[model samples]
Each structure stands twice: as C-alpha cells, then as structure tokens.
Target: MIGGKGEQKTLRLVARHADIWHSFVRPHELPHKLDVIERWAEREQRDTSGLVISNELGHRGEDHADDLYDAGVRLFTLAFHGPDWDYDLVRRWLRWRDAKNA
Candidate 1:
C-alpha cells in the first residue's frame, strides 16, 4: 500500500506502480482521486475493484472513518504524535473492523 500522495505525477505513479494506495487525500477527495486512479488503471487494463484503499486516522478520525470504509478503504493508519495516544479511538475502530472483517 502506498501510504502517501503528491501532485499530478503522484496519480501517474499510482497508476503505473501501485496496486493499493494509502492516499494523503482528505476523505471528501478520495472518490475523485480513486476515479482518477481507476481511469489510469483502466488504460492499463487493471481492474479497479482489485485495488485496496487506506487512510491515516489523523486525517479526520471516526467522523470520516465509516464513510472511508464505505468508499472502499480497508486499511487505516493511526498516527500518534507522542506520549499521549487515543487507545479509545483505536478500540472503537477495532470493534468496527473486527465486525466488518468477520
């Protein structure tokens, strides 16, 4: 999974090099970006449905989590800054994840 993003070249790279992308894009932007990626994938005869999606929890937390999930994100990275961490958020997501995976 490519856990990052960049400019136009980023999409080109994602099209040519990635099978899964962990975009730095905000939740609202994911669909469009995914569409862009899908178009590229299409040009290469790649099946868009086979691509996996991911995001960093720091982007928006659970507020956008479910939507991201619904939009095809299967992986999520929780970025913790330092000493303090939000295990509660993790737990909640874990619950949702486990159930989803189940």
Candidate 2:
C-alpha cells in the first residue's frame, strides 16, 4: 500500500514492477497484509515470492525491529528528519546485518 486508497491498483503495479514492497504497519499486521497482497497477486497470477518487504523504524523500536525481521522484513527504513541525525542504531544494525549475512 504505497500509493493512495487504490488497493487493487497498487497491488497490480507491485505484482509487475516492484522488487520490494514497503509499508508502515505493526509486526502483527504483516501476515494479514501479506495474505491480502497474496490474494490480489493470485488474481493476476502474480507471484510475490521475489518481492522484499520493508518498513520504517519509527516507534517500532529495537524489539519490534527484531520481530519484523523474523517476519521476513529484511529492509528497514529510518527517516533522517533532522539537522542532526543519529547513526548509532544504523551502524549497529548494519553490523548485525553483516554478521547475519556472514
């Protein structure tokens, strides 16, 4: 659900063109949304198997970050909406990623 209220339109476009799908949702909500997306993908016989799921690291915090990661969300987005941004968590996450990949 990247675009407007047009769910079908968004899913359709994602089915064809999206390498990844980004959304702002709770960890508990991921499966249901993926189910909806899968249903929609099935309509067009579109496979979302190759699509990576992503989310923002807002109030989600560290625990939720781990939760989302376990739920298959590998890409986490952090907004730098400031004159001075904190790189601590980002660096730690990168290191974690490296260790995981290694």
**Predicted candidate 2 versus true structure: per-residue lDDT over 3-102, tens digit per residue:** 2223567656766567788856677887877777787788777778988888888745567888888888888777765567777767877776686578
Best by TM-score: 2
TM match of model 1 to true structure: 0.75
lDDT of 2 at 37: 75
Which stretches of candidate 1 lie above 4 Å from their native place? Answer: 84-86
Give the least accurate 10-residue stretch of model 1, judged by summed lDDT: 1-10
Q: Model 2 has how many clashing residue pairs?
A: 0
What TM-score against the true fold does each predicted structure earn? 0.75, 0.76
lDDT digits (tens) for residues 8-84 of candidate 1: 67776777777778886776788888888877777777666777787776647565887788777888788666578
**TM-score of model 2 vs. true structure:** 0.76
Best lDDT among the predictions, by candidate number: 1
How accurate locally, in lDDT, is each candidate? Answer: 0.74, 0.72
